[model samples]
Target chain A: MATFHFELVSPEKLLFSGEVDAVVAPGAEGVFTVLKDHAPVMTVLKPGVVEIDAAGNKEKLFVRGGFADVGLGGFTILAEYAIPVAELDAAKLDADIKNASEDVADAKGDEARRIAAEKLAQLQELKTALAL
Target chain B: MPSLKDLRNRISSVKATQKITKAMQMVAAAKLRRAQAAAEAARPYAERIEKVLANLAGGVSTGAPVLLSGNGRDETHLLVVATAERGLCGAFNSSIVRLAREHIQRLQGQGKTVKILCVGKKGYDQLRRNYEKNIIELVELRGVRQIGFDQGDAIGRKVIDLFERGEFDVATLFFSRFKSVIQQFPTALQLIPAQISANENEAAAGGALATYEYEPGQDEILATLLPRNISVQIFRALLENAASEQGARMSAMDNATRNAGDMIKKQTTLYNRSRQAIITKELIEIISGAEAL
Candidate 1:
């Protein structure tokens, strides 16, 4: 199978970069997979696992909200937070959920409250995924 | 004239100072390497965001998003000044503060309400001497080993909140742009009323803009993207400042070490001369006493 270039970049570091067989991203509306020669599309990412299948090896990473761009040249993921599923810290994730809930409670307006709620929901989902 | 003993003490003190400075230089050099790597690593993401932004911008009408179009008033200005938490980094902190001060003066002179938001301790310390009332908040990242996106996101959210609440009409961020170890200069970026420069336009035009499609329409994506752009820009600035701070410290320590070496050399010369003069006088006294006997 012909492979194309793909890079997964986070603020902390570049997590993955190489030719991949297929890349699956947890998009806002649904989960989608991209392969070589895919049409260019920009999509928002949700807080979930991004699975990358490179040759025979499979890698899954937990990512916070960010964006994925499938361009003609290659596919790129610009994530706010990206870490291996195994490296996810349960205690810190719990603390983040607590803080986000507080933000929701202290939120002043509808928009702020909605945003905070969305963040809280995402953290809760992550917590559930980890079974923490 | 002072005795040779004093010059000896002075030389020893200078040597000690030189050792300290040399050590600091080495430390800064090591730190600068890490900081530079971090800053460089972040560039691709920042550039990619801008590219995506430019592509989306082409579809939307100008002045549509609140972040992109802005609130359309320049009456109130908030300056987010970023500097180093610690000092001894040459003019790194002072230069940022100086630029911010001048900007503040210019804004205030125009009868505009100017507010200061300081990000680092050194900047707050300098600006407080003159513009204490103008300062709104002082954010100190004192013990943070590495600058993170969370910090940038918080600051960006604060600026957006202030804008949404009608607290400020315009916002500007000040930080040092790191070029090299010997070269770093101050740059002020306007955060609020995000302006798309010509370079960004070209970058998007050169990319695969024609092929990409937005999932939920252009305007909707822009609404969320613009706010994230602010956070990304601030994150880049913080990283640049980190690199610049270390670079400045390295150079400053290097100069101090050289200056200490120079002072030691001058003191050693003086000490030797003084010792030789004292010995000659003693010999003359002994010869005179022998002649008189």
Candidate 2:
């Protein structure tokens, strides 16, 4: 299998940087997979799992509120927040869900309420997806 | 002449201060390592974003987002000053505040309305003396053990909200750029109407001939990216400031420890001399008393 450089970076630190066979990222539009020699594209990312395949060793990371830029250099994910799926804290997720629900209740206008409700849904989806 | 006890007490006090300074220096050194690593780790993301932004900005000349294209008037200016939450990092906070002060003075001189947004406790405290009325908000990261993306995002969101509300036409972020352990350069970055250097655009253009296919259209991507870019820039600045703070503190504490050592040496020398003089005087008195007897 051909490999390409894949880097997952958060504001705090670079989570992963190495050669990977493929990267499956959740784009704002939808989930997409990138392979070697992928076209240069820029897309925003939503809160979802990013799966990486390197020599049949698969790894998953959770990312939120960031973007990915695929250039000639490599495929890079600049995530606002990223953590290994194995290391996701259940307590923090629960707290976030609770706060998001409250935000939905407290939101004033239709636009704000819709955004909050969407965030709440996303968190809930993430929770169930992770089965936590 | 001072008594022996007084000299001993003074020497002991100096020694205690020296111990404290030494401990602080060591702690700062350890923290500096972690901070430096964090700052280094964030550089790749910042650099990549800059490159991508430059490319995106190059492609879109007209109808660029307000973040890339100005709101058309520079009547109001916003200064976001980021400093250390705690003082004692030698001139770190003051230097940043000084840069901000100069900026405010310049902007005010231009007959522009200037508003301040302080991101740290020390900056707010220092600028509050004169610019109290101009300070719109203070975001204090007091108890945060480590500066994170969330803190930067909060500040970025606030700035964006203010921009959306037409609070300020121009925004500049003031922070200390960490150069080395002993060198930190106070820098001001214009956030609003984001500045992309010409050379960067040229370089990005020259390097990649491949036309990027922006998902969900170019304007949509720019709208999302420009805002995220603000947050990323603020995040980088915060990380740099954190490293600079630790570096400044390490060097300052090192100097303090050295100064305290010098003081302890001088005090010990004076203390010994005083003790010797006192003992010698007593011996002479006893000898004279014996001779008189």
Candidate 3:
């Protein structure tokens, strides 16, 4: 059986790197999976869940926006913010979402509003994943 | 002549100073170790990412994205100055700010419009006195709960926002690259145009080019990839700064401790000589009085 090496990294740290039979990432458009010898694909990752199937085990990660490169050896996901599902504190994340959402609504100017909105969107994605 | 109490007071002050500096050196040394570790750990990941990006970029055409395209005008320039959040890292912050100042002066002489964005508080505080008008943003991470991607993303978003608005033709990031505890170099890099080429032939470990497939197409991917690269690079700078700062602080405090020790030695020597001279005078007076009696 062939195994693909899957690695996820952020600027601060390397979140995960392991050999997996398959992996799925939420891309800019939608979710896509990569298997051994799957065609090399590169795309932007959206704020969503990334599920990795390694050695008959499944692991899920919540990532903020980033880039993913699926190449000859394996797949690499470069995320701005990548946290394991197990690490996600649902209560805290919910509070974060609520705060972020309120900040967006109360933002005075367009620039502040956009940044606030983006934060809200990312937190909301985490909320969805943790709720599941 | 100084009183014994004064001498004692001076001795205690010097001793206190020595203790403080010695303790600071020790603390800085520990932090420096952790900082160096973090910096070193980031290298492999950074190198791999750069390699992958470089390969993909090499395959893509020059006219693919604005980041890759580089508008062909160096008229307006944006300089992102990243420095340490705290002071006392001997010349670490000043050296970077100095380099940025020189760059700004040179650009101004050429009649180029320049804007500045400061990442750490120290840089902003230092440069703002002169470049207040040019400062577009100031992001201080001193109060940050943690150092992570979210901070980088926030900074990256600002840089991208400015770029998309066409505020500058080129953007440069100034930072100190950590080499060792005693050595750090201020680096000025072009962030815009995504000119940084990642490590070459790194992806070859997996075998041949192997025909890459684009999901949302290469062009769309590049558009986003280029922007994200800027933030990643900025984040890298912050981490490097964090490490370099600790290294600088450790070395600086070590030197300070040594200097303080030398100063205390010289003062003590002076005090001892003066006390000996006074004792000799008093002994002479007592001998002369006994002869008269």
Candidate 4:
């Protein structure tokens, strides 16, 4: 059997570690996938869900943007934030998103506003992904 | 000399304290595991960034990026001191700040201007008393429950802005690097002007070393790289600090608990000896009274 060494880690802890068939990541430019023989790459990740496939079993994870290192032997996904679907607290996350939205609205200047908005968007994306 | 009741109460309180310290030690041990993992996980990204910079910085002129430019000017310096938000970690935060204070004293003695950016509450709180005027900024982590890239990006952006404004020529960061439950070292590193000594590059794990290419020009890539590097460095420092704080606290609490147990044992032995002496005296007095009768 062929399997690619896979790991998904967040700052708090390693969320998942096992051999998986493939993985899909949200890159700065767009969505990217990694197979066993994928070329090496270094890029900034975007907030999205990472899908893992193993023996026809699938699992999804909600992640915030960070960086990913892909090589021939294996791939490691390092997201600024990562949480499994089973672990996501919807109500708490919703409240957080709402507060961030308000913060974005109250931001004073362009820079502050952009940072706040981006944060809100990231939280929103996380919530939406969790809903799935 | 305290009374027996006082001694008994003190023993019970010591026992209670031992229980608390033992519990805290267990909690810190558990948290240290997560913190250590986070710190170790950050190495690859940091190494990759350095590899890219090394490849791009290959014989590149010092004037290419302001970050790599060291005009041998030692007039002004920026010190970024990172510590934990809270305390009670066996002087982990103070150790880093103490090193920074020594650096600042030497820098001041040399007649160099100094600016400081404190990343955690503990550092700012401790350093502000003596160097408040020199503290340019404080990035408080009270609002953040966890460390992440967004915070890193924010800190990175702030540092880059300061550099762009010519606030300081050299930037240094002070932190504690985590190793195990009982050991850690206070690390002082130069952040700005990217001091990647050849020795450090050699020490980096070789298996992960690979050549990296910048799609854009080297200088342009460095413009982004240098700033991001600051934040990434801060992020790593924070992770390491977290682990180190937990490790130190764990060991400190374990020692405290053991000391408390030792105290309780000594007190109990004294109490038993005194009681035995009193019983012996009473028995002797009773036998003498019978003889007198």
Alpha-carbon local distance difference test for all models: 0.88, 0.88, 0.81, 0.77
TM-score against truth, every candidate: 0.94, 0.93, 0.86, 0.73
Cα lDDT tens digits, model 4, A1-83, are 46888877664456777898888887756788878867666566666778888767888877766666675557777666777
Candidate 2 chain B: minimum summed lDDT over ten consecutive residues — where?
B201-210
Q: Against the true structure, what is model 3's DockQ? A: 0.53
In the range B1-293, model 3's lDDT, one tens digit per residue, is 78766877898798899899889889889887877777666665676667666766766655667787687888999999999888888999999999999999999999999999999999999999999999988888999633565677678878888887889989999999999889999999898877754443454444455477676777777666777678778878877888888889888888888988998898898788888888999999999999999
Place model 1 in a CAPRI quality band: medium
For all candidates, state DockQ relative to the true structure: 0.67, 0.74, 0.53, 0.17
Query: Sorted by TM-score, highest first, which candidate order results?
Result: 1, 2, 3, 4
Quote the positional error of residue B10 for candidate 4 in Å: 2.1
- List where candidate 1 sits over 4 angstroms from the true fold: A130-132, B203-211
Candidate number with the higher lDDT (1 or 3):
1
Flag regions of model 4 displaced more than 4 Å. Answer: A1-132, B70-73, B142-145, B197-218
**Local error of candidate 1 at B212, Å?**
3.1
lDDT of 1 by residue, B17-96 (tens): 99999999999999999999999888888887887787777666665887887788889999999999999999999999
For candidate 2, write residues B1-293 as lDDT tens digits: 77778878887887888798789888888998988888898888888778778888777768888988989999999999999988889999999999999988988898999999999999999999999999999988888988787788889988998998899999999999999989999999999989887645586557573478888788887887888889889988998999999899989989998988888888788888877887999999999999999
Cα lDDT, model 3, residue B269: 87
Q: lDDT by residue for model 4 over B1-293, one digit each (tens)?
A: 66678778888999999999999999999898887877887776666566555644553655767777653566899999988887878878889999999999999999999999998999999999999999988988877755676677778778777876778888898999887778889999898788766634453444342443222344655665667667778888888888898999998898999999899999999888777887999999999999999
Candidate 4 or 3, higher TM-score? 3
Fnat of all models, as shown: 0.57, 0.76, 0.61, 0.04
